[model samples]
Target: MIFTSERLVVKTITEAHKKEFVELLTAEEIITAIPQQRPSEEDINVKFEKAIGFDGDISKNPLNIFGVFEEGEDELIGLVAFLTNDDGDRELGYRFRKPYWGKGYATEITKRMIDYSFSELKLDKITADVWVENVASNKVLSKFLKPTKEFYNEYDNCTDRRYTLLKEDWN
Candidate 1:
């Protein structure tokens, strides 16, 4: 496992998880919140490839995607990613299955990820972006990251907000 919280285990995605990962990405609620994860088969395949390719060393391969499973459960309940943006900042992103929403999993795992990013990875800063309409995600992010700005996201055709957390600012 890459990391674990009290009730969840975040680990590198593998071929065995390709099916669950695809289902999580294709859920209607997830698509509604983040339209970027289109349901097309090709896009799903590409995402699966990217996820399984993560080698657990973000410095060498900055694009890392991991499956989030409940403790002692084999099924993947969600996925989280840490990737280097164009500006070379480590950006955090996550999505959970519909059933997993409202269960405090996002906040719990996100807090752990933030701590890991700072302590283990030793990143200078971690950034995230969320659609303004995604209230839950915005709330989760606000708990650990300071809001930087809001702007129109042409690619997603919606207003989005950016947030960042510096290592020095972490508790």
Candidate 2:
């Protein structure tokens, strides 16, 4: 397992998770919150490859995606990632299936990931960027990260807000 919280287990995505991964990528709410376009087959395939390729050693790889599942369950409900930004800073990201929403999984897994990043990975700080219209995600991120800036993303054509949390500021 990559990590675990009280109610969730995270692990590197594998072939067993392909169907659910595709479901997540095609979910309407997920599509709206992210790129806001239907994922092409190529897009889905590329992301699946990256998710499965994660080495489970973020300090060395610096970019990895993992599958999130409820403890005692085989269904893959979501994905969380630690990505390297253009400035070489670690960034946090997550997405859950619609049925999994409103159940505190996002907040739970996010907090766990942040703790892991700070304490285990030894990262000084972690960052996140959220689409302005994704209120639920913005709320989840704001709980742990300080809003640093907002800017227009040409690729997604939306105003995005960036947040940061430093190890020194963690409780």
Candidate 3:
């Protein structure tokens, strides 16, 4: 339930991460990139603490969500997660605070998540979806996942494009 990338640490979220976690989840960027949940300090603290209460237990839930922190910093710059869709596929999801944008952190942590999903977790495929106009997200995903489909999202009022990486296709 922990990962040490070249310059980042992917660790299970804990109550200690409340402040930075709230900052990332409630950033305005989320409404554009990921439009489902409206994160609030109180709400997130309660839910995330319970969901990831046991830091080392990856089997607790397939969500596999973790906080991304700089190697020496205690604050979280962003978060990465695996969520299941209506079709039962584990969708790769990530979001960062506005300051962290354009820093390649998203792509870095994503590669880690994808590697864990396929190589360690033995998943057949990993998928990601972005609002049709989210250029940055689309570009990052394109490196490892191929665009496969597009669907309309009534809630977000935009077309959502889907991308996937198969186990055999991962390198």
Best by TM-score: 2
lDDT of 2 by residue, 8-125 (tens): 9999878999999998889887888875678799988988998888755777766677899999998999999888876688999999999999999999999999999998889899
- What is each predicted model's overall lDDT from 0 to 1? 0.86, 0.89, 0.78
TM-score of 2: 0.94
Q: Is candidate 1 or candidate 3 better by lDDT?
A: 1
lDDT of 1 by residue, 1-171 (tens): 889998999987789988789878777778788755466898788879988877658766677788999999988899998887656888898889888999999999889999889889888899998998898999999999999988888877888888999998988
* Whole-model lDDT, model 1: 0.86
- Cα deviation at 109, candidate 3, in Å, is 1.1
Q: Give a tens-digit lDDT track for model 3, residues 77-106.
A: 888777776567888888888888888898
Model 3: residues with Cα > 4 Å off, grouped in runs: 40-46, 54-60
Q: Rank the candidates by TM-score, best first.
A: 2, 1, 3
lDDT of 2 at 68: 93
TM-score of model 1 (CA atoms) = 0.93
Candidate 1 runs further than 4 Å off: 37-39
Error of 1 at 131 (Å): 0.2
